[model samples]
Target chain A: MTAPNGMRTMLGRVRGLGSAKSGFAHWWAQRMTALALVPLVLWFVISIISLVGADHAAVSAWAGQPVCGALLIALVIAVFHHAQLGLSVVIEDYVHEEAPKIVALVLVRGLAGLLGLIGVVSVLKLMVGS
Target chain B: MDARKRPLSPHLQIYRWQITNSLSILHRMTGVALSVGTLLLLYWLAAAATGPAAFATAQAVIGSWIGRLLLFGWSIALFYHLCNGLRHLAWDAGYGFSLPSVTKSGMAVLGATAVLTLAAWIAGLVI
Candidate 1:
């Protein structure tokens, strides 16, 4: 195989580098989230449409149903997870500074966690009639 | 990283406008858009967890014309991104590599995105 340049070769760069498998995984997750989101998004659209004429309590109560709560929880969780993964790629692409990249990634992960908690707790509150 | 100079393929300017190009670029565009939109989502989530006033304030922004416009844009971006992301998934699975097939599916993604976005907005108006 021909070497790419001064210090690197094409095969060396492509061979089991940090970018292949995880590259596919990142791409896969984005698409997976996109696929997972189809029905979830449709359900959310329907829910939002229903909420148009609803009062606050009505909105909360409607969301408080078991099925609805379950879906909403899934929606938020999927959303946050998808967001984190997407942003991670973006950060990895654009953020050249090492420390900031790690920081931003951690921040995204933390934000995802917070959003997940909010989603789960909200669903629980809706579930127990609280 | 390969820092060596090599013969390059024709760039964007060299090729005629194609659906695949449009859709592929749109994916990146929507990614950036959704990055901003996520902040809005965060606002929504925080408001939902907060008191009624806070939630209403958030709702009020969404109820406004600017908010609606942004939401509308976000909606389209969402659907476009979703469709193209699926297209990407198919590619990753070792499918749709042919140029003709790529263009065909890319058009489908664009068409689906527009249809869904318009339908959603219409549905919103009706309800």
Candidate 2:
């Protein structure tokens, strides 16, 4: 249903794009994670700076704090999710072959998610004081 | 896909170098770098959680000259990505689209990255 001005109807244009549909979800997720990361990343940088030259016990004790551990877990999730979304775009743009693109996308998502989980688990372990 | 050879759309090779273009590319580059740097962050966290011995090993490696060099690069990449991501957010909010404003903001992002990275390193050294 293209119009006289050579523009297809809104629904017509996005008819069969699969999961992404209109891409609003992906765009929003990226922006939301970026927004969350702004504060988390700042806290992380400050924490790391404060911990410089800190002994193992001191660093471990710091991480064992509930506030620190909670924030770190949040940082890990947000950062990895944001990175996964960003990398997916790069792969889609550069890897034109369908099979390779799918493989790369899966690998990126899987690894990012796995690392994110490990990061959270590490923080949780510290919080438990073990 | 088309089977016949046809003139392709203009790409990077056709455009003159500009701050905006450079910043756009640099943003992606830094993003990739930061993604890779996440492994180091994960290692530090895992080591800290594991035990004093593991933590000590992480500290020793990270304190080495080569490790510091890599950390320096990671620091710059982190700052650059953060600054440029904010710029993208501003664009999403429909600001800084004018040519002059775009160029100015690109320069601002670069300046902020340098200043923030420097400040971070100096603070790290002091503390």
- Give all candidates' CA lDDT scores: 0.77, 0.92
**Top candidate when judged by lDDT against the true structure:** 2
Give the poorly placed runs of model 2, Cα more than 4 Å off: A1-22, B1-8
Candidate 1 per-residue C-alpha lDDT over B1-127 given as tens digits, one digit per residue, 9 for 90 to 100:
9999998976867878766666666787798787677667556645655556777888888889998888889899888887787787788789999988987887788799989998888888874
Q: Residues B40-112, candidate 2, lDDT per residue (tens digit)?
A: 8899999998888999999988899998998999999999999999999999999999999998888899899
Give residue A60's error in model 1 in angstroms: 0.4
Name the regions of candidate 1 deviating beyond 4 angstroms. Answer: A1-28, B1-4, B8-18, B49-51
List the lowest-lDDT window of 10 residues for candidate 1 chain B: B42-51
lDDT of 2 by residue, A1-130 (tens): 5566566777775677778675888899999999999999999999999999998889888988989888998999999999999999999999999999999999999999999999999899888983
The CAPRI classification for model 1 reads as acceptable
DockQ of candidate 2, scored on C-alphas against the true complex (2 decimals): 0.80
